[model samples]
Target: MGANAAAFASLLRGATNLSQCRWILEQLINSRYAGDIFLGNLALQMFGKLHGIGDARALFHRMAQTGRNLFSWSIMISALCRDGHHREALGCYHAMNLEGGIEADMVILSTVIGVCSALQNLCEGRKLHDRVAGCGLESDTVVHNALVSMYVKCGCLDDARAVFDATPTREKDAVSWNVMMAAYSSRGKFQQALEIFNDCLLHSVQGPDAVSFVTAISACCGLKDVKQARALEELSCSHGFLETSVAVQNSLINLYGKCASLSEARLVFDRIASKTALSVRAAVMEVMLRREEKFCHRFVIAFMLPSILMWCLGLVF
Candidate 1:
């Protein structure tokens, strides 16, 4: 019966029919589970993917009645996020604090961090982060990466940096390195990001991704590292990064312009593939053209952002 439940859950994963997944979960509940913890957790995962949070929650509660386990708790909390029930999920985390005599493992903490990010509850995420550290699960790389990403996405670059700094040197994978670069570049700290780029070059084991390159170029734009930015732009092409992505060229345009090289920016813009690219290039270009005229007239502190404000300028001028 337990094997059947797991196989049914596996089958449910491939089916997009939420109703069918819920039905299978119901079938599992109607029949005696006989303390089959694995099948219970598997059912929880299937319902989560199908967005069947109500049924998943019910099953999780049933599991608790039958000498509940950690897997059941994590699964239910994760499924609860389908409708943005982050706060409820956090409550679940606290409720199960002593009942099961189990603290949140990596999976549980990751789900809570994700919830915290959705709620923009950075303070809560930090408190949980401290818990992860105090509990000695800080050595877990997956949790470390998740914490960094959650902090970065929530616009708490400082917290992201603190997490990055605390990451053990041995566990710093490419994802961890990229997260650190992103945390710095996100807040316009391009100089520090560039130095990280140099550090990445020194590490023979680490190979940065296109996302990493984009972050480095973004840092260049902030620091007006036109020369180094230009070098990276050329290197991207020479290394055959396929220049297929509009984001890559867009970064080039922004970096060149920030380096005070409008002409080079134009060259980069002209080379962009017209297909599969969003209209943001046109929007950015409009703003860049306006900045050309106002470079001597106004402080224009918010160059790229000023493009939206230029729509009002267009109506006036």
Candidate 2:
């Protein structure tokens, strides 16, 4: 019976007939079945992935009535989270409290933190933070990272930094570092954010992946450092996805203009190659032209790049 459960779990992953799979589950229900706990939990998970919350919820309720274990609880919480029913998911957590004897681990804590962020329930989220500390999981790096992101999402920058600083100075993972950097970047503390980027590299957590570069380039734009920003753009080129993000391209143009390197700025601008690219280009030129206006006698705005015509006509935005 356990082997049959395992086979069902695996076959369910393939393009099997849904009606056939439903019939098997029905058979398991009727015949004094000895289904594997792992397989039942797998069904709960697979339903979430294949259908939606409606499907996962039905399977979850079935698992609960059969007196399944904590894995069932985690699966249900995760399914609710992925389906964006964050408030309801948090409600499930509270209702299940003192009932399942389930100890929330890093996976559950991280998912719950995301749910809080999605629901924008900062107060309940903070209460969960206290619960994490009470459980002595505060020092766990994954939990700490989740807390920092939760604070960031809630617009509590000060609290985010407080939790980040409280992290033990031991080696931090890239996830931890990235979340802190993202928080600071969001608040326009780009210099401090870039420092975190450096620390990310130094700690060997990771070397500038595309997302990391995008975040770091954001900081560079705030600092108006074209040279360093261009270097990041070049590094991202090595990742084989020649498709640069619009954010990256826009930031590069701004940095170059701020640094007064109009030639480099024009080069980056031309590569954008899109109609909507005009606004970011306009914004960059607007910022630069506004600055260069002080020297209006010395510089002219027209005839820099081919797209200067488009920049002139206000089509980019």
Candidate 3:
């Protein structure tokens, strides 16, 4: 029985689609090992991977009748959340808690926190924050980042900053810095955003990525500090983002356009190897709106040419 159960579990893991998975489950039921906890959880994971949430939920209900474990709950909740069923995910989480034996671990905690972030449920998010504290997972960097993102999305900057500051520096990843920087930038706290960007460079081992540069450049744009924006342009070049990231290029174009440095903006726009509609629109809008006397003809040529070409190619949907 043990060897047969293991073989069925292996078959389930290798199953690539719903039909294959169902065959394995049928084999398990016929073999009278369908109730095995490990096999049951493995089946749930495969169902989730196959985007079979409906099937997974049915299996979960059956497993619950016999008994479910931590892995069972985690897989179900994660699958539901992945499918954008945030409310349903929360419902499963509450059921798991009421079940009253399986302790919530970091995996479920982070996931549920993110569900709250997606739903923007600040009240539920705050309750989960306390649960994290109770579980002694407040020091976990991933959980801390999730909490920060939740608060920021909920418009709770103070709470986000509190979590960000509490995170140990050694554990802070690029995500940690980017989320905080973006929060401040979006709130019009440009100087604070730039301060965080500088601190990220000086302190974080992970340093910055393209997103960090984008946010910082946006802050410089908000302040209209051409000097600082130029410095950031250089930094972006040094970090190898200027050549690779279209987002960084777009932000620079907007920054230079806002600063009335049309030449520099044109330079960035001209260098894009593959110009997206956004890049073209940014250049066109900035030129037409910022220095119409200088680039009015250029805007008509730049914007209309590509748009006409896209329409011809049936790509303008």
Candidate 4:
């Protein structure tokens, strides 16, 4: 019976027919293994993926009658968070704590911390940080990464930096480096972000990925440093980052525009296969406006006006 329930849940995962999924789940609920914990959690995951959070919440309340396990609690919390119910997710976390038998694991801790981050609940986040330490789960790299992200989100870069510094060498993955760099970049600390990018090069066991390059290029845009931006662009290409990442290409265009290199910006812009038309257009126009008056007028008449007219026509008709 349990096997049948799991199989049904697995089938529901790939199921596109919402009505059929409902029918199948109803069949399972009427079966002998309806109380199976694994089936209940798997059903929650399927429902969340299908945007049936209302149904998932209903199922959660029913399951809570018999008492939910830790995994069940985590899934509900995660589902609530993914659906943008941050306060509800936090409330669920507290409820899980007060419910008593089940302890918080890394996944739950990470989810609640993320909720706190999104809500910017610093006092609650700090208390949770102490709870994490007391639970001896602070050494978990996943939880550590979450704490770094949470602190950064709450605008406590000092606290974020402290967490990053404490991360063991073995556990400092690319995300850890990326999050730290992002924290600095988000605050307009471009030089500090670049410095961290450089540190990633020197220290991280795993090399920078597309996200890393994009963040660093964004920092270059903020600095408006043409020389360093060009160097970074070259470095990204050499690492093959530009070959697959459209975001890196877009950032290259913005970086060159910010540095007043219209020609170079156009070169990068032309290379993007799937361009975001309006944003690219805006960047091009900003660079054109900075050029000598004669060139600017000629370029605007020859290029910008037509593109704008075309975009407006597409929207209208």
Which candidate leads the pack in lDDT? Answer: 3
What's the TM-score of each model vs. the native? 0.75, 0.73, 0.87, 0.83
- Candidate 4 per-residue lDDT, tens place, 1-317, comes to 45676688777777676576677678768987677777777777777777778988988998876457988998999999889999999999999889898899889998899899999999999998999999888868889999999999898999999988887766778898899999999899999999988888878888788899989998888999999988998888898877667778778877887788877776666565555655456455656667545544644555567778998999999
Q: What C-alpha RMSD separates each model from the true structure?
A: 7.8, 6.8, 3.6, 4.0
Give the better candidate number (1 or 3) by TM-score. Answer: 3
**Residue 57's lDDT in candidate 1:** 80
The full ranking of all candidates by TM-score, starting with the best, is: 3, 4, 1, 2
Pairs of residues clashing in candidate 2: 278-316, 278-317, 279-316, 279-317
**Candidate 3 residue runs with Cα over 4 Å from true position:** 1-7, 14-16, 270-278, 291-317
**TM-score: model 1 vs. ground truth:** 0.75
- Weakest 10 consecutive residues of candidate 1 by summed lDDT: 295-304
List, residue by residue over 25-143, the lDDT tens digit for candidate 2: 66656644434566667666776665457766777677766766777778888888878788788877776676757777767877788788787779988988998889888768878
